[model samples]
Target: MSEVMGQQKNNLELNDNFEDHDSVSDSQVVDYLFAHPDFFVKHAHLFEELDIPHAHKGSVSLVELQSEQLRKKVRLLNYKLNQLISIARQNEQIYRVYADLNLRLLATQSMEEMQLVLEEVMQERLQLESVVIKPFIGAYAFPEIQRRLFVEKRFRRDKFFFGRLSEHERKLLFPQQEANSVALLLLGELGELGMLAVSSKDPSHFNPDMDTLLITQLQQFLSILLPKLMKY
Candidate 1:
């Protein structure tokens, strides 16, 4: 009887101890660690023992995981910075070309002079194989098939079209020349005047994916210049 009573007493003591230990919650431990910042410094070995969940695979040490995350962020930032720099350099080059063309256009005294200068500059500086400024009347006079292929399909409403051209379209725009791709910019307001067609032998030279800000600006500039030139 006395042995049974002693066993029960021991069980009660163990339950009390467990209850006391359970009173210290996980938040309390985190709070205690925050209170003592030097705790990790005092126990440097804990760094090796600490395991953090990783994005892939099993686990990694806390320090190792943090370092990896920082490296990834740095790589992402570097890639973005490089893209911005590349875009800026490209914009600078485009601006220089546009400025040169604008100066030449402004210097011309007549429509013939402007056309000659425009064609020569585009071929020499811009690497275009063929450049033509077709008047609306000329475009209207095109054969039914040619008009439907280029005018009706491409410039029905859009001010600009850039991409590979069909063989017939290429031949129509650039007769006696081999052109694999073309960019057509509507010359006047709602294309009342006509269009400017620039072509290249390289298939990828003009595509819909290309940035058209520079081309759009050039179109607007020509719109202002062509009206005055036509009056001359």
Candidate 2:
């Protein structure tokens, strides 16, 4: 009986030791790999032997799984690269169109010719819904009260206003045309010359946060040109 009891105690202690040794956690394994980073480099054959559970396929070799993950990352990078390229090409085209319009504007002899040139480029080339130039004190001037209100409200701080306009403002600026979104440029040094309203069908097309580099150049050129044209 003593011999049997001693044997049983020895068996229990061996089992307990085995359980403790087998209790290696996933975190401990990860820490071990992180410490010995070159372990995989030394035992490269493990890449073939190790199985990584896959969502689509039942399981894949470590090398194959890593290759797939890399391919997905490359595809995502390519998609973003293509989007940037497309935007750059669009910006270049816009710059060319504005450059051509500037040249045409420089050659205009009268205000009528200037207005026609603006309408032609903005409507036809830029594909804007409408374009209207309203001089402060002239035959085709915006209503005095309306002009003052717009200057006070829209051009209170900035020389440019973008995004949606009130119904009254829309009607005054674009008479019969639909203007979901509008870009209102205050002409002259202190916005005394006129207002140049450019509209688009797309509601989100003209936002205040949009880059004004091209339109700013146009505004400066118009400010200098309008005074000379108004004299005629």
Worst 10 residues of 1 by lDDT: 138-147
- Per-candidate Cα RMSD to the true structure, in Å, reads 7.5, 5.2
All candidates' lDDT scores? 0.81, 0.92
Q: Which stretches of candidate 2 lie over 4 Å from their true place?
A: 1-21
Which tens-of-lDDT digit does each residue in 95-193 have in candidate 1? Answer: 898888888888777767977887887888877898877765442334555545676788776889999877767777888876888899877776766
Query: Could you estimate the TM-score for every candidate?
Result: 0.65, 0.88
Q: Candidate 2's error at 161, in angstroms?
A: 0.5
Per the 3 Å backbone cut-off, how many clashing residue pairs does candidate 1 have?
Answer: 0
Residue 156, candidate 1: alpha-carbon lDDT: 70
List the lowest-lDDT window of 10 residues for candidate 2.
134-143
lDDT of 2 by residue, 8-40 (tens): 999999999888976888899899999999999
Determine the backbone clash count of candidate 2: 0
- Error (Å) of candidate 1 at residue 186 is 2.4
Task: Quote the lDDT for 140 in model 2.
Answer: 79
